[model samples]
Every structure is written in structure tokens, then in C-alpha cells.
Target chain A: MKELEDRIRQDGIVREGNVLKVDSFLNHKCDVALYDQMGAEWARLFEGKKVDKILTIESSGIGIACVAATHFHNAPVVFARKTESKNLDGEQYRTQIKSYTKGRTYEVIVAKRFLERGEHVIILDDFLAMGCALNGLLEICEEAGVVVEGIGIAIEKGFQPGGKSLRERGYQVESLAIVSGMNAETGEIDFA
Target chain B: MKELEDRIRQDGIVREGNVLKVDSFLNHKCDVALYDQMGAEWARLFEGKKVDKILTIESSGIGIACVAATHFHNAPVVFARKTESKNLDGEQYRTQIKSYTKGRTYEVIVAKRFLERGEHVIILDDFLAMGCALNGLLEICEEAGVVVEGIGIAIEKGFQPGGKSLRERGYQVESLAIVSGMNAETGEIDFA
Candidate 1:
């Protein structure tokens, strides 16, 4: 976790409107070593829990979740698709999520066959700000009748209420790096 | 590669409109063990190539490329963005690509800082049908002056022109499973 926090401090860019750009090592351009470490940390945190599958959302979370799935005994990763595609035709559990970064709301879906009833799953994603994305995944998991084991996040905006709300809802959320505060003008970030 | 072919035969769903759905273990739901094997296979095929980075597209390719990067000495994986987002700011290399699956044209962008001039990279993707996606990535690589060491594909429709055209272009394309023909009615698949 220290390594991730340090890397975020080193490469994470604070932008206006509380936007933290970590595309350098987190999202667009990925550091697989860091992703492996984050996966290890999550494995340690969720040691005793049963992780039948690792669920995530497309575009960003796919890489991190897939890499981290290696640490979880190579658990199968099921990423919820953020867009409707010709390839995605089947019975699916769907939910709508508002993207703070993309400035639009989109439907996220996972095929019904992917998430079976009574299966245990851990949801992982890159960032947790408003928790809109995670909430949508949770809704799908509930609909599929899968047990929510825990939530693993690479980074979380602690200044926002997303992390707190999920914790209060009794979900064990493990975030490698939590940004408590950030300043775009001075380019300073505080970790929680 | 045999394992991949066997898994495909077992789980791949052949639908109308030349769609081969292997989402059971390839794209939508990923088998990390299979992915690790793929990475090792690509490592074997593209061995001795100076791979500085692994480039891919978003959604499906991200997971495969990140898992494959571990075999490339944990090379950083950079995935091109298919949509504009607030998180994607600053200078970028952009290209227009037509999606046969989504039935739309979208702009793919990669940050200018991710692909440096003279850097050697291997482009990896989930599938190669018409090669529209790979061509867009190749265009970005050309504009960035990056050397494409090779292209690794998980599945290639050999009947399609993508693989033939790319091979004709003198690019080494290693497809784990190349489908020469498939029947939607009988669910028969032939591998080349």
C-alpha cells in the first residue's frame, strides 16, 4: 500500500474540480508491477473470504482486475460492459451508472450466466469517488444473487462521501490509496 | 495454444452474422489461467524482440494485454481510449476506427506521453477480424514513431482479411487460435 500511495504521490496529477489524473500509472497507461502489488495487498486484506469471481467495469478496471485476479489464485474476472454492443446479446443483469469523469450516464451489464446464484465475488475498480460505478455493480451482484465478499479499490477520494457510505453499508472496502485532499493550484495531495 | 483451441471449441458460441462468441472465457468473463498461458505463449513467440511497452485498446484488450505484460517482464501496458473523458486531458494521438461489432465509428486516443518515439512495442488484442482496431493502433504507433515489434492476437478469423493483410504488411502476428471456418447452424469450427 505504501508503494501505491507513493506512486500516486509521484505521478498523480491534481486537476480542477477534484479531478485526480492517474492515467500515467493507473488507468490509460498501466504499471503492471504496481497492479500486481495492489492485487497482493487486496489478497492479504481479503485473505479468508471466498472469491469465486472478480467483477469489474469496463475500460479502466479491466486491466487492474485481471492483473489482480492473478493474485487471487487466478480467479475468473467478469467485467461489466459499459456500452451496448452486438457481441453483448443475451440475458444480462443491467444497471445505470453516472460517470463523474466521463460526464455521462451509461448502462452497465453482466451476462446472467457469468454471475451465478450463491457465488461469492469481490468487486474491484480503479477509483471510488461518488461510488456510482461500484453501486451499479453491487446492484447487479444483488440481482444475480451472488454474495458480495468485499470491494478493492486502487484509489479512493476520501474527501468525497463514497468510501464512507460504502463502509457504513457494511461492505469491507480496501483501497490501496485514499486521497484525503488535493490541490490543483499547488499540486499537493494528502492521503488518508 | 492447443488448450486455447480446445477451450474455444468447448465454449465458443457461433452466432449469425459471422460472430464467434468466446465471452465465456475470453473477453466478457476471463480465465486468468488461460490468459497467463497466452502471455507465456506470446512471450515464446515474440521472444528476443525488444518490447518496451505493450499497447492495446480498451474493454476486452486491456485485460488480455495487462495479463500478457507480465510475461514481457511486466512491461507497462498502455490502452488507447475509445471515448473522450475528463480524465483524458493533455496532448494525445488520435485516430478514427470503425467498429464492426458496435456498428459505429469512434475516435481512439492515446496520450502523447505514453508512446515515446523509438520505443519498441507489441500490440495485443482479443480478436482480429477486419483489423480496424489494430490498424488504428498501428497508425498511432506510426505517428508516435514507436517501433511495433509484433502483434499478438488471441483469436483471428483467418477467413477475414485482417490477419492476411497484416501478415502481408510484414508484421509478425501470432494468433493463438486461428479460425479458418465456422458454422452457426452446426456449431462447427475449423482451425488453421
Candidate 2:
């Protein structure tokens, strides 16, 4: 966690409207070593939890979840696709999610066969700000009747309501680095 | 490679319109153990080549490429995003790609800073059929002045012109499993 916070401070760019650009190492250009370490930390945190599967969203979370999965005894990772494709057919659990960055609402779905009833799953994602994406994933998990073991987040905006609301809802959310506040002009970030 | 072919035969679905769906283990619901094996296989195939970075596209390729990066000494993985987002700012290498599955063409972009000039890279993807996606990635690699050491593909439709054309281009392409033919009605697949 300290390593991630340090890396964020060194490379994260704070922009207007609380936008933290970590594309250099977190999302777009990934550091697999750091991702492995994050996975190890999550494994340590959720040691006793039964993680039959790892669920994530497409695009950004796919890399982190897949790499982190190596630390979890290579648990299968099921990423919810944001867009509907010809390849995705058959029964699926679908939900709508609004993207803060992309500024649009899109449907996210997972094959019904992928998430079976009574399966224990841990949801992982890169950023947790408004919690809309997590909520959508939670909806799919709920529909599948799978047990929510825990939530592992790489970075969370602490000043935002997403993390707080989830914690209040009694979900065991473990965010590696929580940005309490950030300054766009000065480029200073405060971690919780 | 034999292991991959065997798994494909067991779990891969032969759908109508020449679609071989390996979503059970490869893309949608990922088998991390199998992914680790793929990474090792690519490492064995592309051995002795300088892999400064691993380049891939978003969604499906991100997971495979990131997991495979571990086999290449934890080489950083850079995934080109398909859509424009607020997080992606500054100069970029952009290309247009037609998706056979999605049935539409979309713009893909990678931040200019990720792919440096003269850096050696290996482009990895989940599937290579018509080679539209790989060609786009290669175009970006050319514009960035990066040396493409090789291309690693999990599965290639040998019946399609993509793999053959790429091989004709004088690039070392290692496909774990090459499917020469498959029957949707009989569910029989032939490997080349």
C-alpha cells in the first residue's frame, strides 16, 4: 500500500474536477510488478475469505485483476463487458453503469454460466470514486446469487462518497491508496 | 501448445458463422492457471528477444498481455484504449480498426509516452483472425519507431488470411493453437 501511495505521489497528475491521472503506470501503461505486489497485499488482507472467482470490469480492471489473480492461487477472473458484442450470446446478467470519466451510461454484463449460485467472489477495480461501477458489479453479483467476499480497490478517492457509502453498507472494502484530497493547481495529493 | 489445443477442443464452442467461442476459459471468464501456461509458452517461443514492453489492446487482450508480461521478466504492459476518455490527455498514437465481432470500426489510441522510440516490444492478443487489430497495433508501433520483436497470439484461424499474411510479412508469429477448420453442426475442429 505504501509503495502504491508513493508511486501515485511521484507520478499521479492532479487535474481539475478531482481527476487523478495515473495512466502512466496504473491504467493505460501498466506496471505488472506493482500489480503483482498489489495482488499479494490483497491476498494478505483477504487471507481467510473464500475467493472462488475474481470479478472485474473490462478495459482497466482486466489487467489488474488478471495479474493479481496469480497471487490468489490463480482463481479464474470474470470481467464484465461494458459493450455488447456478437461474441457475447446466451443468458447474461446485465446492469447499467454510468461512467464518470467517459460521461455516459453503458450496459455491463457477465455470462450467467460464469457466476454460479453460492460462489464466493471478490470484486477488484482500478479506481473507486463515485462507486457507480462497483454498484453495477454488485448488482450483477447479487443477481447471480453469489456471495460477495470483499472488494479490493487499487485507488479510492476518500473525499468522494463512493468509498464511504460502500463502507457504510457493511462491505469490507480494502483500498490500497485512498486519496483524501487533491489539488489540481498545486499537484499535491493527500492520502487517507 | 498441445495443452491449449486440448483445452480448446474440450471447452471451446463451435458456433454458427465460423465462431469458435473460447470465452469459457480464454476471454470472458479467464482461467488464470491457463493464462500462466500461455505466458510460459510465449516466453519459450519468443525467447532470447529483448522484450522492453508488452503492447496490447483493451478489454480481452489486457488480461492476457499483463499476465504474460510476468514471463518476460515483468515487462511493463501498455494497452491501447478503444474509446476516448477524460483521463487520456496529451499526444497519442491513434488508429482505426474494424472489429469482426463488434461489427463496427472504432478508434484506438495509446499515449505517446508509453511507446518510446527504438524500444523493443512484442504485441500479444487473444485472437487474430483478419489481423485488423494486429495491423492497427503494428501501425502504431511503426509510427512510434518501436521494434516489434514478434507477435504472440493465443489462437489463430489458419483458414483466415490474417496469420498467413502476417507470416508473409516476415514477422515471427507464434500461435499457440492454429485452427485450420471447424464445423458448427458437428462441433469438429481441425488443427494445423
Candidate 3:
């Protein structure tokens, strides 16, 4: 966690809209070494939990989820699809999520074939902001009758309410780095 | 490669319209152990190449690329963004790729900060079909002045022209499993 925080402070950029851009090593351009360490940390944090599978949103979450899945004994990682594809089966557990980053509402879906009843699902993602995406994934899990094990995130915008809301719901949410605030003009960031 | 081939024969669904869905292990629901074997096989195939980075498209490709990066000495994995996000910087190298699966044209962008000029890059993806995605990625590498050491793919639809085109262009392409044909009715799969 210290290493991730340091990496964020060193490489993260504060953009105009309170966006903490970590494209250098977190999202767009990934550092697998750091991800390995983060996965190990998540393993330690979620140790002894009944985690049968890892669920995450597409694009940014895939890399982190795959890396983290290794630490969870190479558990299968199921990523919700953002776009409709003919390849996907017609019967699916779907939910709509509003993306603050892209400023659009997109449908996230998981094929019913992947998730089943009584499975412990660890919801993972790169960032947790308003909790819309996380909520959508949790909804899919609920519809599939999958038991929510815990939530793992690489970074959390603590200024936002997602993490707090999940905590209120009695979910164990673990974020490696939590950015409480960011200043675009001064390029300063505050962490929780 | 044999392990992957076996997985394909067992779990891969041969759908209508030449679609072979391996979401069970390769893409949507990723098997980290199988991916590790895939990464190792790619490492073995592209041995002796000077690969400084692993470049991949987002969503499905990110998981494989991240896992594959481990076998390449923890090389940084850079996934091209399929959509514009607040986190992406203003400066980037972008390419338009026609998706055969999705039936549309979309832009893939890599931050200019990641792929450096003259750096060796290996592009990894979950599937290789019409070669449009690989061609688009090659264009990004061309624009960034990066040397594409090779391309690594989990499955190559041999019936499609993508793999043949890449090999025709004199680029070394390693596909873990190449499918010669698929019978959707009988669920029979033939691999070359």
C-alpha cells in the first residue's frame, strides 16, 4: 500500500476535473510488477474469505483483476461487458451504470453461464468513485444468486461516497490507495 | 499450447457466424493458470526478442497482456484505450480499428508517454481474426516509432485472414491455438 501510494504521488497527475490521472503505471499504461505487489496485498487483505471468483468491469479493471486473481489462487476473473455483442448469450444478468469518467450511461452485463448460486464473488476494479459501477456489478451478482465476498480496489476516491456506502452495507471494501482530494492548479494530491 | 488447445476443445463454444466463444477461460471469465501457461508459451515462442513493453487492446486483451507481461520479465503492459476518458491525457497516439466482432469502427489510443521511439514492443491479444485490430495496433506502433518485435495471440482463427496476413508481412506471430474450422451444430472444433 505504501508502494502504491508512493507510485501515485510520483507518477499520478492532477488534471482539471479532480481527475487523478495514473495512466503512466495504473490504468492506460500498466506496471505489472506493481500490480503483482498490489495483488499480493489484496490477497493478504482478503485472506480467509470465501472468494470463488473475481468480478470486475471491462477495460481498466481487467488487468488488475487478472493480476489479483493470481494471488487468489488463480481464481477465474469474470468481467462485465460494457457493450452489446452478438457473441454474448441472450440470457444475461444486466445492469446500467453511469460512468463519471466517460460521462455516459452504459450497460454492463454478465453471462448467466459464469455466475451461479452460492458462489463467493470478490468485486474488483481500478477505481471506485460514485459506486455506480460497483453497484451495478453487485446487482448482477445478486441476480445470479452469488454471495458477495468482499470488494477490492486499486484506488478509491474517498471524497466520493462509493466506499462509504459499501461499508455501510456491511461489505469489506479494501482500496490500496485512497485519494481524498486533488488540486489541478497546484498539482497537489491528498490521500486518506 | 497443448493445454490451451485442450481447453478450447473442451470449453470453447462454437457459435453461429464463425464465432468461437472461449469466455469460459480466455476472455470474459479468465483462467489465470491457463493464462500463465499461455504467457509462458508466448515467452518460449518469442524467445530472444528484445521486448521492452507489451502492448494490447483493452477489455479482453488486458488480462492476457498483464499475465503475459510476467513471463516477459515483468515488462510494462500498455493497453490502448478504446474510449476517451477523463484520465487519459491530451497527448496520445491514436488509431482507428474496424471490429469484425462488433461490426463497427472504433479508435484505440495509447498515451504518448508509454510507447517510446525505438523501443521494442510486443502486441498481445485474445483473438486474431481479420487482422484489423493487429493492423491498427501496428499503426500505433508505427506512429510512435516503436519496433514491433512480434505479435502474440491466444487463439487465431486460421480460416480468417489475419494470421496469414501478419505472417505475410514478415512479422513473427505466435498463436497458442489456431482453429481450422468450427461446426456450430455439432459443437465440433478443428484446430490446426
The ten-residue window of minimal lDDT in model 1 chain A covers A82-91
Candidate lDDT values, in order: 0.94, 0.94, 0.91
Over 4 Å off in model 1, which ranges?
A85-90, B84-90
Each predicted complex: what DockQ?
0.93, 0.93, 0.91
Work out the TM-score per prediction: 0.97, 0.97, 0.96
- After best superposition, candidate 1 residue B117: deviation in angstroms? 0.4
Q: Model 3, range B61-135, lDDT digits (tens) per residue? A: 999999989999999999988864444456888878998787798888887889899999999999999999899
Better candidate by DockQ, 2 or 3 = 2
Q: Residue B118, candidate 1: how far off, in angstroms?
A: 0.4
Poorly placed runs, candidate 3 (over 4 Å): A84-90, B84-90
Worst 10 residues of 2 chain A by lDDT: A81-90
Q: Which candidate leads in DockQ?
A: 1
Give a tens-digit lDDT track for model 3, residues A34-116.
Answer: 99999999999999998899999998899999988899999999999987544455678888899887788988888898998
Deviating ranges (above 4 Å) for candidate 2: A84-90, B84-90
lDDT of 2 by residue, B124-178 (tens): 9999999999999999999999999999999999999999999999999999999
Indicate the worst ten consecutive residues by lDDT in candidate 1 chain B: B82-91
Q: What lDDT score goes with residue A39 in model 3?
A: 94
